[model samples]
Target: MWIIGFLLVLGPLVTLHELGHYLVGRFFGVKADAFSVGFGKELAGFTDKRGTRWKLSALPLGGYVQFAGDMNPASQPSEEWLALPEEEKRKTFPSKPLWQKALIVAAGPFTNFAIAVVILAAFSLAYGKIEIPPVIAAVSENSAAAEAGLQAGDRIVSVDGRPLNSFDELSDVVLPNPGGKLTLGVKRNGRDLNFDFTIPTIVERDRFGNEFRIGRLGVASGPGEVVPVGPFEAVGLATVKTVDIMKMMVNGIGQIITGRRPVDELGGPLKIAKFSGEQLSLGWREFVSFAALVSINLAFINLLPIPALDGGHLAFYAAEAIRRKPVGQRSQEWAFRTGMALLLTLMLFVTINDVISLPIFSS
Candidate 1:
């Protein structure tokens, strides 16, 4: 079940991500040397009429596309790239205008985001959107809200000066601020007021005993109604949801880097497989929803400013634009090498974290 779920969830997402790059590069007249789903040894593949080797490789964690005149799948320019004949150079990725190169590099991550938005939109269409009022119905004793002098019947108008239309928006602001202070704009008895307090942190445990640290204001919302939305509204809501998830990811990573969150909170492929299998067992809806979350995660990770990733290439392009020339080849090579090493070390750490959190190790 685990193996099946992992493959089912990751396979299409990774393939489409690479396809995004391939399609855009092709559109710009850049010739692709190879398109691979996965890394390492090639398990199965075939060459196309355009001489592009489309292959399914052994490792299935991620994938890449190698453009003409590229050194490897990472798309670093080959040393021999400059020596290529004029006709051949024209087809290589490096020969493209700077803007075109940036678009090709960015297409992969944006494609993942698009996939997530589509999935979420489908879900919204199937099940009406949940619309909850921002009014506070109850406040937990001694909780953050109570400590801040909030009471039942208080209508939350905003958080930290940002206007809130629904209770759902509150979580988007609060969840990412564990142990952080926040200001709340409230309306009570038709009078406007403001309250400030530190959000309380709580450790939550799932049925499987996995623990998560989160922020809690300890206020209960009124029972929300399901409001049917049109297709356009569904897409808009899905886009908002995707952006919210991305924001949470950014906050979570910032917390980890600042030592506000434990490093063990980070998980790699093993953890994903475990969750994927569990969600698959639940039903198709759960499984597909999990896949959407993973898709957004992939998009966010690849957009980080790290070398050997899409964002890294975009970073170099930005530098090129500023200086009006490509960065020195030696500098790019060394930066890529360093970035690859950092990624590998982080992967190893997260894998170890996942393994130790497994049932067998826990027992």
Candidate 2:
């Protein structure tokens, strides 16, 4: 069942990605020969009215659409295609204007991102959101909360005289006002404690291993209180939430690069499969959250400027747009090869990290 669920999640995402390319290509009058949902032996397939063969392959990791003029992505067009009548050649992807080609290549990643946003919006509306009440759970020794006279068990009723219903609301007020004095109204020991507290500068580690200063008040939040929201509000909140998650991911990647964070924090396919299986046990909500997270990861990852990725292709397009010419096929191939090597190395490294990080593996 876990395997089935993983495949279902990945299969649709892969199909949706390729469908983006196929639809955009057709929209631009480009001919696509094959649209596949996986690699290796075909499990099921059918030719569409446009003569495009859509197939489901045995493997489930990823898939692609083969455009007519793309006999070899790195190879120059064949003499046959070049000699073809101008009308026919015009429909070939290689013969399309640079901008059109770039858009076609970019559509896949864009579709993934768009789908993620829509899914998040839907999920947020359906499940509602739970946020931590603006309540302090504890104050660490010598921490900013301690210095601010925050008690271990205190309900933060307001910040700087503004009533806050949740810790999330307090964060909006506190994070931006870091290092500045603010008035806090707390309910503790059957009495209201009002005090002026200064937010402290906190060091946050990024993905690549570097640390940056941010605001902090060593106060822990309790479990979130679920709040229902309307569709419009859900959509707005989901967009904000998505951006927030993406920021954290980008920051984390920076920390890893700076060596402040270990690569072991990264997980590859193995970790995802394990997580999918575990989420399956917890029921639908956890599974949906896992799916949402992976979708966000997909969006961010494809945006990386690594060749063979959507971001890499976009980078090439940007260069072409600047220089007013396409990159040579050989150069593109070389860049793709280098990118593939880097990607494989990273994948293997992260897979190893996943194994090491798993307690079961240690046993």
Which candidate has the top score in TM-score?
A: 1
| Candidate 2 Cα outliers beyond 4 Å, as residue runs | 74-80, 129-144, 151-166, 169-228
Clashes of each: 0, 17
Per-residue CA lDDT of model 1 for 168-270, tens digit only, reads: 8998788777988889999999999999978788999876577888899999899999989889999999999999899889889888999989998899999
* CA lDDT of each prediction against the hidden true structure: 0.90, 0.77
Q: Candidate 1: give the clashing pairs.
A: none
Top-lDDT candidate index: 1
Off by over 4 Å in 1: 72-79
Q: CA lDDT of 18 in candidate 2? A: 79
Residue 12's lDDT in candidate 1: 84
lDDT computed for candidate 1: 0.90
